[model samples]
Target: MSGNTGYAEIATFFRRQIADGTLAPGDSMPTQKQVRQQFGASITTVNRAFQMLKAEGLTAARVGQGTTVAERPRVAATATARLRRISRTGRAYGPKERSVDHQARLLSCADPDVAAELDIELHDEVLVRSRVYMKGNVRTIASFSFINPRGWAAVPESLSPEPLERFWQEDYKERTGRTTVKLPERRGARLAYPYELAMLKVDAPPNAAVPVLVLLNTWHDEDGPLEHWQDVFAPGLWDSDEE
Candidate 1:
């Protein structure tokens, strides 16, 4: 076979097997060499077929484990659940209040996009707080929050060491007599960056082609934008707009 014919044939063979239960989830796939020999196909054809399987989330290849039928992808909690929990407990996720593990830092707002989002001049200093919600040792969701110092000058010089989402909410209400009414969000997906990969502490799926969910959210009140932040959810680790 030539052109895409060989690729399609090889991919269809595996797809059929998976559907027929011949290749069960968590089962190891034949090695590339074995596939090549069995299909009398080129290495390129075999690789293409494997790529298709991975893109379809039907298989995965690990560094030392070779290719295997992928296990069922984990489903994460909905954003509504997280928000309701935060509203009640002042933390993103944890059995106890104020237990979400997180970090915070002050950084110069150098990125033009961030500056634009915060309506601040380039190079202005902003406080960036990052929260990582975990189910035990397994990380569930990661959030980065950016606050414009000028708009929130009333914030105390020293912020509490705990996760700041609840604190911020309270402070904003106290100062402005307004609650955050809208969280306009944009959602997309892209391959994790180096820093994101390190922070999430997970290897990219199969061929480094699986993209994680990126959610950009801007909090607004009657006045204007209050805060702009981004949340990066690990693959299969979050669902939003759940009905």
Candidate 2:
């Protein structure tokens, strides 16, 4: 087979083995040299096959550990699922949201994209609250709440540690004595950036072609935008109602 076809065939061979349970999670894959010799393929071909598997979240390579089968991919809870759950429970999705176990950090907003989203100036301070939703051991969703420093300071004492969504809503009411009328959300897919990959603990290499779902939300009233939110999810973690 041609070099290109060899790489694809190599990836397919391993993918089928993984699907059939022949190559269980944590099972070590053959070394690149071994694979190249076994298939009579070039080193480039074997590396390409490994890259493909890594992008699919099926395998990982680490220093001193070699490449091994990854844990089964977990499906993330969609926004629709969370909303339905909230409708039934009359609360946030579950204890995770209500608890203080998630990660939150305050940082300077150096990224122009985030500054524009929050209607703030570059280098301004922002409060970023993050939570990773896991299905068993596999991380499914990584959520971030970006708040303008001014708005965060104005939040009431009672709602100091509340969810970002709740904080925004309450802050708006406290300031204007009126409720927010609109929360617009936009969703799209993009390759995981380095910071996101590290945050999510994804096993893919930098600039890998794995697709991550990006959900952007902005809370607004007659005055203007209240806060901006960005949620990143592993592929298949979130399914939109429209899709």
Candidate 3:
């Protein structure tokens, strides 16, 4: 881990160890000197590896505390479970979690991403729902659901705080004269902004931001896109496959 890719290599080594439970939460990471000696890397290179882990919210560092694996809630619920529940019962969280708070309202579509996904013009009024899901006292994820234009008229319940299953079908058939299809989704990850971290109640010590998982789901039909939902999952949400 000492050449041009030393930083990335060292980072991935520790990342894998953490993922597989070789490094448990609250367990101290090897000191920078130890890492540099083991990897034959420069001090700067070793620091970069630690920085990557910190930014990802996988570890924490302090003057006396050094660096330790960050403690995280072990909620067994998966994203697929929540999606299935939403499709069947319109609930945001699966059986393993619960909605702690929810807010819903109609507003002009100010987000360009949402407009592109829903194939709608900017400034068009649409339904927006914000929710925070929790497992026991710990937050599991924070989500924002944007209902496309069709659901506004046909499924007025989209404006309510309550979750609605198949909110697009009644309107899809009326507009396209056909049944709706499946919900297309995409997942990604990026460093969370300061405000978002506060909203999700995350702490990223020694760094300004933490990593987050993003889920973008679309409910569309043969005619075109109908409704788009963006779910922002909080840090430390364990994916069984990844583990």
The CA lDDT of each predicted structure is: 0.66, 0.67, 0.70
Q: What is the model-wide C-alpha lDDT for candidate 3?
A: 0.70
User: Model 2: residues >4 Å from true position, as ranges?
Assistant: 1-74, 78-88, 94-101, 156-168, 171-176, 236-243
lDDT of 2 by residue, 110-170 (tens): 8898888777789888877777766555666777777666556666432244445544556
Q: Give the higher-TM-score candidate: 1 or 2.
A: 1
Assess candidate 2 and give its TM-score to the true structure.
0.56
Off by over 4 Å in 1: 1-73, 78-80, 88-101, 204-210, 240-243
TM-score of each: 0.57, 0.56, 0.57
Rank candidates by lDDT, best first.
Answer: 3, 2, 1
- The deviation in Å at residue 10 for candidate 1 is 46
Candidate 3, number of clashes: 0
Look at candidate 3 and tell me the lDDT of residue 2: 53
Give me the candidate number with maximum lDDT. 3
| Tens digits of per-residue lDDT for model 1, 120-157 | 78988887777665544566556777877744565653
> Which of candidates 1 and 3 reaches a greater lDDT?
3
